[model samples]
Target chain A: MRDAFHEDLDKISDSLVEMTRLVGSAMSRATTALLDSDLGLAEGVIENDVQIDAIRDDIDEMAVQLIAQQQPVATDLRIVVTALHMASSLERMGDLAEHVAKVARLRYPHKAVPPQANATIVEMAQIAERLVAQAGSIIAAKDVDGAEALHADDDEMDRLHRDMFVLLVDEGWEGGTESAIDVTLLARYFERFADHAVSVARQVAYLVTGEWEHKRRVGAPA
Target chain B: MRDAFHEDLDKISDSLVEMTRLVGSAMSRATTALLDSDLGLAEGVIENDVQIDAIRDDIDEMAVQLIAQQQPVATDLRIVVTALHMASSLERMGDLAEHVAKVARLRYPHKAVPPQANATIVEMAQIAERLVAQAGSIIAAKDVDGAEALHADDDEMDRLHRDMFVLLVDEGWEGGTESAIDVTLLARYFERFADHAVSVARQVAYLVTGEWEHKRRVGAPA
Candidate 1:
């Protein structure tokens, strides 16, 4: 019986890792769709997000069932709860990718991101893809060290985000208000994508370390 | 023992409703601070968010304990899990309110919304406050009809968001790119706030009705 429970636990981990892979692909494809104005690719990414949601729903359902039936305690319980949390973060990551795709679809042939900010947006998308892929490995291997290292990727994404803002708000900038709005929101989507990746890594860290890394500064208005 | 478990479940519901109230107040105060440039009020909202987080942490801890100890089944297990989901959504609502406060602080001594957009932003904030307060009653009473009514409020918010976009992008508008960026992001923050509120209402509807609402569109981007 205990073996069966452990097996179920392993399945949950597998499901989360699977979610990460799907999310990573979604981000990568969504970026391509945005850059190339490829409506078909953008539509595909949006369509696949449902698969990510289904996996999340499955993991959540399975975790809840395991808790009710197996009556896990201590670390076992923590693992199940953390899996649920990770599933949620992963699903949000997928949704962020969908949001990016939606922007691409909204702009169609015009391209949501302008040429001036294109390189930076591409880099941000690459970072988001890499970070989520790494997040998957961290969950699969339960590597606390790998989870901690995700912070660097998050920092890089943040740097790109800040640079994008600076560029858009520069005095000599010529992107017009509409393009500025698009780039600003697009940068935020990528930044938030990385944030969710870090959040998932933090959950993985907690699952392995049994101690939360940080309390997120309770009064932080932002 | 079963009766005790049921009582604990009631307590979880109460905690969620309490969280809703805190979030509602935070949004209201943050809006005032943004529109009025009231630094003290903004800071106060930021500070109070900690209380919301503590309540969420408590709900999470209690729900986990109940699941572990009682090993609840069927609807009992569903109720516990839904409470956790609701607590998470409410906590995120608080964080969104904090984000609004942070923006207000960042722009202190200067208004975040321009004179033209101020009234619309204020209206959005009011709708958010009303929706969340109604959400509190929905949770407390498990009022499915009230939860259903939240959709109209969310629709109003979406309409405002769309109109704000049009206003910002119109050729005659003169808010400048920086101000345009601020208003755009502010509008998005409020739109997302409403989205989260609707999500919470959907969760409540699920708890009472046991049917997920429309699966949120599987494809077509956005």
Candidate 2:
């Protein structure tokens, strides 16, 4: 049987996992919105970000309340503090998704991503979804191995980012400066989304293994 | 007389101010490097980021240790919790400055800011410096007014960011796709740096007034 403090911690953890799910869905839809230029779907992702922020607020309040009431020490305290950080990362992921959706909206009926970079954007979107999904599993199960595997997914995202850059600078590239700007920003959003997912996974791994380096500040350092 | 916990909190607060200083200097130097294409200065900013990371690690350890040893509750606990979030924002500001510096290095021997957009970049960098400097003052003084004033500075940042976009997409833009890409990312880095500064200020202000909204999750939400 769990104590009240542990119960609160579990709820916070559960909320975090729920956050991962919502953020995952957010990015998944935002990716579709970007590629398909679906205005309504883009609007939905932008509007729903508030829900993610609300969950973060709840987690923040819960963690602070837990600390004041339980006065947990040592590892328990670390868990609470780290939960705040993870909540933060999750919230930022939601914002990044919103940014993607807004980009789609800005372009309207025209697709934000051009043809040369479509495949890479699609793959990045897929990996972003997988990363956050795996981040959910990692948090729920505290699976360190799952955390270790997330780095590879992030690596692929980085490679796709580089490929996009190459296309942007290519001599034969048909996309004009305006398209290039949109693509560059879009690519960065996906890369950062994947990064935050990996950060969440790494934090979970560290909390489980008691081996956080504290150096993973900016979501895997690109 | 201040108790041991307050003393520790003071030290943590001091470190946050120090972080603002480091991050401020970093942005100042990064701007110079970007404009002048100074390889050595850019390299210095990139290398010195580790020190910023180290301070954050120190702040993290100090905060968690305080929580373990002090068991602070009520407003005191909120102050400590808010400190951790402030440290995070400052650290991210450091990363953004480093990113700006890296862009400088990437375009070494060639200026990152083109002639058309030079003035805006300079103005953006100046505001970034002021924002961090004021963030330091706000943290040290715990001034609510200082915190409130930060919003205006951030609004200026947003304005500058918009001006940058106008310059980029203008028909008269001569920098081509690559420069547009670089300018877009650099502009974002400065804008985010300012946002984080405002976030730190708001956290300090809230800790002082005991009115933290918890909705300022992603640093004032744009």
Largest lDDT belongs to which candidate?
2
Q: Write the per-residue lDDT of candidate 2 for residues B1-222, one digit (tens) a residue.
A: 989998999899899999999999999999999999999999999999989988987887898899889888767777777888788788889989999999999999999789999999999999999989998998898786677777777899999999999899899999988899999999999888888888788777666655556435434442
Model 1 alpha-carbon miss at residue B221, Å? 14
Candidate 1: clashing pairs of residues: A221-B98
lDDT of 1 by residue, B163-220 (tens): 9999999987777887888888888878877777777766776566544333233111
lDDT tens digits, residue span A1-222, model 1 = 447778888889899999999999999999999999999999999888889988877886787677777777766676676677778778888988998999999999888888899999999999999988988988889887676687678888989998988898898777888899989889988988888887787677666654532423211112
**DockQ score, prediction 1:** 0.56
Model 2, range A1-222, lDDT digits (tens) per residue?
988878888899899999999999999999999989999999999999999988987887888899989988777777787888899889899999999999999999998788988998899999999999999999999786677777788889999999999999898888788889999999999998988899888888656544546435434332
DockQ of each model vs. true complex: 0.56, 0.64
Residue A206, model 1, lDDT: 64
Off by over 4 Å in 1: A209-222, B209-222
